[model samples]
Target: MRESRFIAVKLISVLKPVIDRRRRLALIVDDTLMARSCSKKTELLAKVYDHDKHEVLTGYRGLTVGWSDGNTFLPVNFALMSTKKKENMIGNQPVTADQRSIAGRRRTQAQRPMNAVTVELLKQTKKVYYRYRDRLYDVKGLYERLAAAKTRQ
Candidate 1:
């Protein structure tokens, strides 16, 4: 049999069991910092900016979206966000939730893709999701999107 690049995966038909035992499997999304970059010899740090003051106010911050498999947490999404620049602090300063996007209304939006390792990890991560078929093929096309992002990288 010839080997195909993409696996012909079938959606499994099983509801997630509510087992109280620790052996119950769950999804785990994790991100590890490879390194950091800085100007001069300044110390590199992972800091989430202050949402109000819009400043890099020390300490590590990143978003990792996960899915609970009725037992444990499974990381399904992770985004490494760059610190928002304090640009135009005087013009349209302090953007609130209802505030419009700085880029303004859009007609044709850009398709920014994802990284490669994320793609491979996502590919290897789908086995946990087969139990979700009755909940709708909720994770459909996730792998393709991840692969596209890898190619973009």
Candidate 2:
């Protein structure tokens, strides 16, 4: 099936007011992993990476994202974290030495953090969806980055 067009009800300029009024936009950031092509169950392996010089524990991971109602949990956003999981994402050395241990590298990746993803996800939530449960339909047009930008403004 083909996805439809996404219309952002809230504009970026107005988001600050919405957030300030409610204190928070009700966001939750997490990971979820779908099976990679031609792969079975997820495995725990310290796979050597081409980009980063060290091996990372690769269980074919992604983010399990959603949102919360202060005291309650409701899924609003689900952004699959970039699995490349590099150090440049963090304020650390952009290179890794093969001589390094898996523990050392993963520590760096974890430290890199997902603050950017969190921010973008929240923004996407406000822009794309009017209400959480109300948007079970696939949003369109937004898949096109340039088009989405025009709508956000």
Candidate 3:
């Protein structure tokens, strides 16, 4: 995750020159299903609802947040989400890593609700691109969840 952030920071620097300063920038958030239908043993694999297909499927939900200036779009950060429900989970192995370690934290994040993860992603993005603090748009219904996550911290 640290490596990915480093790369994203560098990419932003490279793209900054091309992005028009006059136009409004947007912090886009969305999720998509990464289907793994054939693999039953994949770690953290779970039953995720595919919005496009309108059905539950065996896979991970790729929750992503990106930056765009109307024309150019650059993905800033993402989390692979997994179902927390015991019955919906497919390959739910015990995470043996230390809770403070990246792998353990990532596993914990995967099981969290999408709104929580989205808040975290946005916070991380804010840290990376501090200049665009005002540009981070809150998705409808997420303000309450964001406040809850902050109080827990």
Candidate 4:
């Protein structure tokens, strides 16, 4: 994961010059369904709603945050959200990874609510790129958290 982040940062630096100076950078947050309907044993697989399809589906919600300047878009951070409710989960195998390991941490994070995970993705994005003129997130409580973060700094 750290390696991927490093690559994303490098990619951003390389692309920064190509972005139009007249346009402001914005943070965009959104989620999509990652269908794993056939897999019963996949880790963290859950029954998630597909807003586009307007129905429940067997999959994970891939929440992502990205940076965009009218012309170009670069993904900054993301989280795969899984339902914590046992009834909604399709895969319930216990996570055996050590708590300190990245895999374990990520597995734990997957079970958290989507809004909380989205906030975490925003925080991670903020660490990588500090300047953005606008934030495009639909989650409730996100503005409050970001404002609180700003006040702390």
Arrange candidates by lDDT, highest first: which order?
A: 3, 4, 2, 1
Query: For residues 1-153, could you state the per-residue lDDT of candidate 4 as single tens digits?
Result: 555656777887888888778888888887778988788988778888777788998988877787888777777788878877888878865566468887887888888777667767777777777778999875445667767766877
**How would you encode candidate 2's per-residue C-alpha lDDT over 1-153 as one tens digit per residue?**
001113123232344444444534444454433334433232222222332323433333343334443444445554433333343222223245243876454444433334444445556666655443321212212235424454777
Indicate the residue-level lDDT of 145 in model 3.
65
The segments of candidate 3 whose C-alpha lies over 4 angstroms from its true place after superposition are: 133-153
| Winner on TM-score (1 vs 3) | 3
Clashing pairs in 4: none
User: Each model's TM-score?
Assistant: 0.28, 0.32, 0.81, 0.84
User: Candidates' lDDT values, in order?
Assistant: 0.34, 0.38, 0.78, 0.77
Q: Against the true structure, candidate 1 has what lDDT?
A: 0.34
Candidate 1 displacement at residue 101 in angstroms: 42
Order of candidates by TM-score, top first?
4, 3, 2, 1
Candidate 1 lDDT tens digits, 19-130: 4444434443443332233322222233434554556544322334344545444345444423233341112222243325633211001111223334433444454343
Question: After superposing candidate 2, which stretches have Cα over 4 Å from the reference?
Answer: 1-25, 32-56, 85-113, 129-153
In candidate 1, stretches whose alpha carbon ends up further than 4 angstroms from where it belongs are 1-15, 18-44, 50-53, 62-65, 69-121, 127-129, 133-153
Candidate 1 lDDT for residue 54: 55
Top candidate, metric lDDT = 3
- Model 4 lDDT, full chain set: 0.77
Lowest-sum lDDT 10-residue window in model 1: 105-114
Per-residue alpha-carbon lDDT of candidate 3 for residues 1-153, written as tens digits (9 for 90 to 100): 756767877987888887777977678776768999998888899988776778988998887887777787778888988978899989856456468888888888888888878978888877877655334433445567666877998
